[model samples]
Target: MKVVIVDDAPRVRDRVKALLHADAPYAEVVGEAGEAQAAIRLIRDMRPDVVILDLQLVGASGIKVLRAVKLAPHAPRVIMLTNLTDLEYQITCLEAGAEYFLDKSFGFERLADILRDLARKSGPDSEERAVL
Candidate 1:
């Protein structure tokens, strides 16, 4: 399962990558970006199966990247991870086509689990599950 990590904080990106590696070995970190434009470009070029996107990016909002990803052909499943835990923000992300919206404070493990489930569903033994 190819995955992309997009976060403005280098530490956060590294932590997420490490967590994914430690918990979801089947998930591969294919690409990463810290800003909206670069993240959008990477997503378009890499065509990863999943993208761990930060809701807050460097000098830009992650929603821009999300919108671009959603507009692309064969969009990947996006999980919005943000420090901002406002209900409205979560709803906004969901409405914008994010498969999952998680608060950064406690969503790391849950994100890993989601990735694992996605990997299992995409595996040869499982039935074909269409993922966008």
Candidate 2:
């Protein structure tokens, strides 16, 4: 599965990408971006299978990216990787159409497994398994 990883912190981006790549060799990380606009352009152009996004992204908020991604044709499922654990942020993200909101503090390999399962599941099945 192809993925677009967007995070403001270089270390976080690299680590997530590396971990994902290591976990699933076929999971190619097509691109990476530090801010909203660039990520938008990349997503529009690449149309990756999924997006792993960080709320602390520079320039625009990750919520905007979620909104923008939802507007795209065949919008990729978004798994929000954020440090913000507040309910407000979580609620806003769900309302905005993010598939999952994950805390960066947890084990990311588990997050990748969820992504893989989501990718493998059918529409109805995927919708039923909403835990992130």
Candidate 3:
């Protein structure tokens, strides 16, 4: 599974990459970005199967990035990984077409499980689409 990680913090990106390497080895991080515009451009260019995005970016919010890319042709399944665990933020991200909205503090490990499921579902023998 091709993946892209977007977070302003370098440490968060590194940790996520390490987690994927350790848990979801099938998930390949094709690219990463530290801010909204760069993320948008990288996501557009790489067309990854999944995107791990932060809710708060350097200059623009992840919502903006989500809105911009979620409707495009063959849009990737987006997982909103953020520190903001408020119900409103979760609701907004889900409404904006995020496949999953997770709290960074509590839901970090869940990301790997989600990715593993996704990888299995999208494996060569599976007939269903990956993003579904």
Q: For every model in order, what is the number of clashing pairs?
A: 0, 0, 0
TM-score of each candidate structure, all chains considered together: 0.88, 0.91, 0.89
Tens digit per residue, CA lDDT, model 1, 58-109? 7678888888888876778888888886877777777777877887888887
Q: Write the per-residue lDDT of candidate 2 for residues 59-109, one digit (tens) a residue.
A: 899999889988976888888888897889988988777778888888476
Listed per candidate, the RMSD to the true structure in angstroms reads: 4.3, 1.9, 4.1
Ranking by TM-score: 2, 3, 1
> Can you tell me which runs of candidate 2 are displaced by over 4 Å?
123-132
Top of the candidates by lDDT: 3
> Best candidate per TM-score, number?
2
Worst 10 residues of 2 by lDDT: 123-132
Model 1 error, position 92 (Å): 0.9
Model 1 backbone overlap count: 0
